[model samples]
Target: MACTQVLLLICLWLSVSDAFTYLRVHNKSEVTVQDHWFTQRLDHFNGADNRVWEQRYFMNDSFAQSDGPVFLMIGGEGAANPGWMTQGTWITYAEKMGALCLLLEHRFYGKSHPTKDMCVANLRYLSSQQALADLAHFQTVMTEKLGLGNRKWVVFGGSYPGCLAAWYRIKYPHLAHAAVASSAPVKAVLNFSEYMDVVQASLSRNHSDCPRMVKLASDTLIELLDYKENYIKITKDLYLCEFLVIRSEMDISFLLDTIAEYIADVVQYNNDNREFEGVKGGNITIQVVCDIMSNESIGSPYDRYTNVIQTIMKSKGEKCIEASYQQFVKDMRDISWESSASAGGRQWMYQTCTEFGYFQSSDSISQPFSGFPLSYHVQQCSDIYGEDFNFPVVTAAIQQTNENYGGLNVQSSRIIFPNGLIDPWHILGINASLSSDLVALPMQDAAHCADMYPARPEEPPVLSSVRRRILELLTEWLQL
Candidate 1:
């Protein structure tokens, strides 16, 4: 083809592609109080054309026209339900502070399903980088479609979204006026090693009188590790003896991690499960960690172990008696005693261990872990053990924030990081930059998000101070 003809074809392709793939925004509906939920569609960067990305946000109380600072709310993992307690609770508070609230659901969660096939396809795309991009794109859409041009908003979030909030300001400091990260993971990845250490320290510090109990707990773990084979043997036996059933599909780690987590919980677990028949009245203190970690196995450890031993002996026949169990026992004992750092005793120890690169297993192929998605397992075990379970994605997200935010050379832009002292996830060990624009508030006994509590009769004194600081900063920010 001639040069002129080739140029005309290229131009035609560019125009057609732009028209087809450019981002498009549509207004869905306006709520009673000037709040509107809108959806936007954007073409994927990769040429995966079938995947149409969609995101939603709530614009409340003059977000489009507000001269005051606008509040953009970013939620943590699996926060698809827009009406969840935290978002709902803070909506009115944002309005009261003279700020328009914008709540955006993280992609792959809630109504923000950007792609289909959640398990196989979407899970791969669900990362901190993509989430940050989605938020940025939504900001641009809101600016053009809602007439809130050139007005920067403040980003806020707790738990997982806190990391996003920090990243938003870091990545687009010019787009955000300020940022407020509550219970944010703005430093390291979620280290299970550090988290378990916090749990162990908390237990020992809070319950010094239970030294004997702690020692017994430690000893039990050592014994279990030492007799991994025999322990499995006995557990199998016990399960079969009770139910007269024979199933060799037992996962020993499940039992160990479950019991480990149970022991971490502050409360004692004294239940009447058929599996614990042999040790029903035994002095081993059980807690919620064990129960939550334990999958629904039908039999007891005693029966399960016995069956395993019997099977092994039967299979070996004459050779079984001559087999040296002493070496195996010694190795187990070694792993049990030496491998366990006191910091590794928390119920969510696996999460910190995997994320912070501190976990080691004698046998390969462990359970799926990292204490993510904040399911019932985390909520029950963490709450029972006095351990806070936040979203795990915050780990990578925070590192990105620090890298970008620290390099911005931003001045006159303030960042307020609020955290609860008792929030074991963040672990009361963070070093904030000593800049005039940054303030760190460590609230006492506040748990996680301290701003949403009604002053209670049994509340800790620090809760009052936390509440006070939150009001002070927010009120001053709003000029209320």
Candidate 2:
């Protein structure tokens, strides 16, 4: 799917609490936001190579007091946007606390490219350890450059960056005072089949029949792939831009994975309403998707599935869905920074292949979706980078990551992990408080960083209380 369309689905479904009416709204023209760059080492692990790169960061000091705290929003896999300075509940907290806010774009993402290109050789420098080091160095450099003396720094991030926020406090406890890791997948696994299991659970929570219909649709599509004539029918029904070909298992995986992604995208961001730099949120909720799937007027389960894809494609203004594995490989194979795949796709995939093997596969029988298995993603690592990044290497890397970071057993203080109960990624996040200072706050009816957004009237009461609790924790930590 197109980035904007995916973002639209992501942003539109958010529901929040009613405590953020006091958030200061700054006109874009009023905020004097400027792009700041800091010189950072390209390879923090290698002391021999002295190569440096300019890292991008943005700051908003509109509410800063002389002795106030610092709020650092860590950028994740995607490009960091300056708009976050003015939006999000973090800004609300900053305004209330009179804290200075800063957002650091992750290396190799957005305009903060550490290298000229994203080839396998250059991407070797991209890892979670390197990113954590970037944060430690950034804090030290910025504290001196800005003359910040003994000010408490609170780190905030969602999704992948959320994991980083928790890990940062664990690795460099002296640098940051507190962290808000929202919807963070702290644990790394080779086959994330639980991802789809949660997706089905979320769907069933909305309507029990929805999962049955989704499974039926998937099975029907798989059966159709056996006949050559059904290929043309599937192509026409799904509205593919190219002819559907099932010459290999990879091709079959591509088709099923593409279909599963449409559903997963909705479930992941269902009710998440934060707006991005250039994209606005929509109302494509799980209920909306289930309604489409259950509407027998559309035809069979397979026909309804086709309609789901067509609805998303039409919303994005895409002419046809791309289901060709060769085209996908060709796009990912392009190492140039100018390629469309460079917009976090290739970079994130590399991180998954190396540091985090978070491959969401349908290997489990409990999940509704099927066809794409563990080997499908393992092969992708080999096809995109090289055979060196095979299953054994990737497995070892995940093991090392868990050993280094402590994964679910991460021992960190003054960190609040707020996760949505319905969010698929919550399977790997901390669901209960480990101690008094290290807290796990699970929102009753939330999904994927819903707490990070400004509170809304329709949000569950637990969400309202969670925001208040987060503020309370931050206040207590800063006082210490």
Candidate 3:
């Protein structure tokens, strides 16, 4: 959650894209989707750079009408799966409105690689500014190629792509007529300590004692870590792949951060049972975690904590928990696309280091978790990239992001910002409606990107109503 090491580990266990938090790809759909490609410039800002790459996009015009709107689902930090063209709430909206649906894979993600490899030099072109330009250029090309003259365009994205969706509307208002930014973190911060605070709140909201147990477990782990002799005991009890070795503070922080992420993963995607590329999401809720922590028969708080880790690991078919700092650095340093860590993890880490400092740390005393500090994340950026990407550089980048985008006070219209109250990322999103056209719909008892998924029979009534309202707004904006 803090760096590429934790992110890659989460990606492996959760089988979800780190670029878009919990953005699932459904395998089955009623509509037929086709993949297409267009020539996209490597550097949109540079006039001298005539270099180009084939950008991949998916299209489903099954329900398109001559004068209907275009529904553009922007792909985030993952591969653009064609499943999105046939499924999701956007597809349903497209069906009803007779809109042409499109899913543009983000450059440098999936198969849309802009360069040869993810080496440090090639990654310079992989920024939000470049991505936004890619969107704008794609819009122009699509409008001309498809003869969609003056037709209204609606953009939809969740998580990081959601942030892009909102920013797209702000930056290129004329291009995108309306936008649906779900669980979008518009505000960028260096120390995202509030993420864990929200996680704590989500846990405590389910059961007050859950946070207490979690804190007790963290204290116990810290105590064990303080004594060098307890390394083997800690490693064996936690089912770690290797014996604990505390060469530096980061080594200890890596283990603790990873443990905290097990809880964060559940909290972030709690009860959002959206299917991902044929895999159904687990129904693991805060209560599920709380039930484990509060069971007295499960031994001490430390035992319950280890149980939580083991349960998640076993569910994901992981043999042992990876807590080695050297392994983390090794995986992160390998910039090859063939590497396991190259699955948008390194790219996202670069973005976090250079653009959005979404460094989730346990520095705050308000949160139940501890051990992972802001320095741990900052050190990761420097470790993976170079000394140039230090704390001061990261801080400056975050400040510039806020200054450029206007943070939560983003000036945009005819865009709907939907956030889940229980989601940790909601802290950076717009929770209040800015105006008549700029609407914010905050869903209670919802997790990250809940509204983006297709409607299910067991879904909350409020989620249903929220989807309906989104359609209603789009109808008004497009004047259909």
Candidate 4:
């Protein structure tokens, strides 16, 4: 978690964009979401009249009355799924209140591209402020269209979008009655190394040796990178598909990411009740990792690590073991932007490069591996995005974010910040109250966006209390 702040790019592949993972196991049934679009402005702050684009959204009116609350789920870096309206605690809350459910896609993400292309010139409209405006406008249009303009509304989102939900209530207080921000990292900082610290703590919770062997295997990989003689065995030991072509350090870092993916995935999804109620060990969970670590017959700690890596890679169906480390290292002196994956990773990277600055650099030696240099990520702002993404520009943007949104110390009312105690990104969340109205719940035995997902069988008592509190708050706020 140290820098893989892609919580804008969840997994590290070029195509992967779950940067901050929000599970959307959407089961399509009868097309509940009536997909629609709003004519949104390209630049809410600067665009003139007629400078418009379509923003994607979905609405479900099953539980709606002529006069009822609207439950809005704010989509983040990934595509908006219809399941959000059907699944999750919010839908249940919506059901109880007979509220209409709506899902608004983030502008640069899903099918809500506001510009012709994701070029630097076009992506200027992809700021958080603009996205918030999109929500405000969407609400204005939809509520009015359905003759529900005067009715109360409640917004919801988890992870990065969670930050948006919190900030939305803070900024656009008149648009919605309350918001539920699950694991929202409101604070945008340059160095977010605290992620791995939580990872360390989570592993340590299971058994002392879990994080220890992870570190040992990391060190072994680092030591293996230096010796030319060990190259062949390195491939064989890690079960490489081909001879090591890239720098061993990059390969080592990528492999470390591969390893981190396993540990992080388990901790990220450690809400066992959601997947397995009382079972001690569930698939791809912390217990499973610990079970792997406990296997003494797996030979040395390195071999145990190898077995885990093999399992992870095979699950991903990876044929080769090379890192795409060279893409960001290109000379920015002669760089041109491309409209590739900008709707997803490239757009998230732009947001990260500009405001969040949560680069997942493997700089800390005490951690597993140096994933990427900060400059490599910072430069990629211009390398792939635009020239305005340099360090100076991004630094100013971060300050603006903190000043405008109150990063980590949000002063909003009627918003609930719920963080799973085990989530690596929890370190960035508000685990306490800023005021009587701005409350936070550090949900125990949870990970990532645990509170955002639908409740499961025998849900943890803390989660039950959280759900009850949110429902109560939203109900009370709307009635007032």
RMSD of each: 15.3, 7.5, 6.9, 8.0
In model 3, how many backbone clashes occur? 0
Work out the TM-score per prediction. 0.56, 0.93, 0.92, 0.84
**Candidate 4 local distance difference test against the native:** 0.71
Which digits, one per residue and each the tens of the lDDT, describe model 2 over residues 1-480? 211100001112112122111233354336666676767877788799677777888878778888999999999898898888887889889878989888999998988888767888777788999999999998997887677899999999999999999999998999999999999999998899999999999999888899999999999999999898898999998888899977799999999999899889888888776645464334667888899989999999989988887786775566888999988989998877799898999999999998889899999888898899999999999998889989999999999989998889978799999999888999999999999999999987798999998677866678888999999999988999
Reference-based lDDT, residue 379, model 3: 98
Worst-scoring 10-residue span by lDDT in model 1 = 1-10
* lDDT measured at residue 164 in model 2 versus the true structure, 0 to 100: 94
Q: Candidate 4: misplaced stretches above 4 Å?
A: 1-31, 47-49, 236-242, 247-255, 272-282, 314-322, 327-343, 363-383, 386-388
State the lDDT of candidate 3 residue by residue for 1-480, as single tens digits.
122211111111112122122222332354545556667888899899777777888877777789899999999997887878777889889878989888899988887877767778888889888999999999997787677898999999999999999999999988999999999999999999999999999999878999999999999999999999999899998899998899999998999999899899898888885675454336566888899999989999999989888887776667888899889988988877788777888888999999999889999888888899999999999999989999888899999999989998878799899999999999999899999989999999898999998778876567999999999999998983
lDDT computed for candidate 2: 0.85
Task: Encode model 4's per-residue lDDT on 77-132: one tens digit a residue.
Answer: 97887767566788778778878788889987877766555555555667888889
Count of clashing residue pairs in every prediction: 35, 9, 0, 11
Q: Please list the C-alpha lDDT of all candidates, in the order they appear.
A: 0.43, 0.85, 0.85, 0.71
Give candidate 1 misplaced runs (Cα > 4 Å): 1-51, 56-66, 84-93, 119-121, 149-152, 211-215, 221-250, 259-412, 428-433, 452-457, 475-480
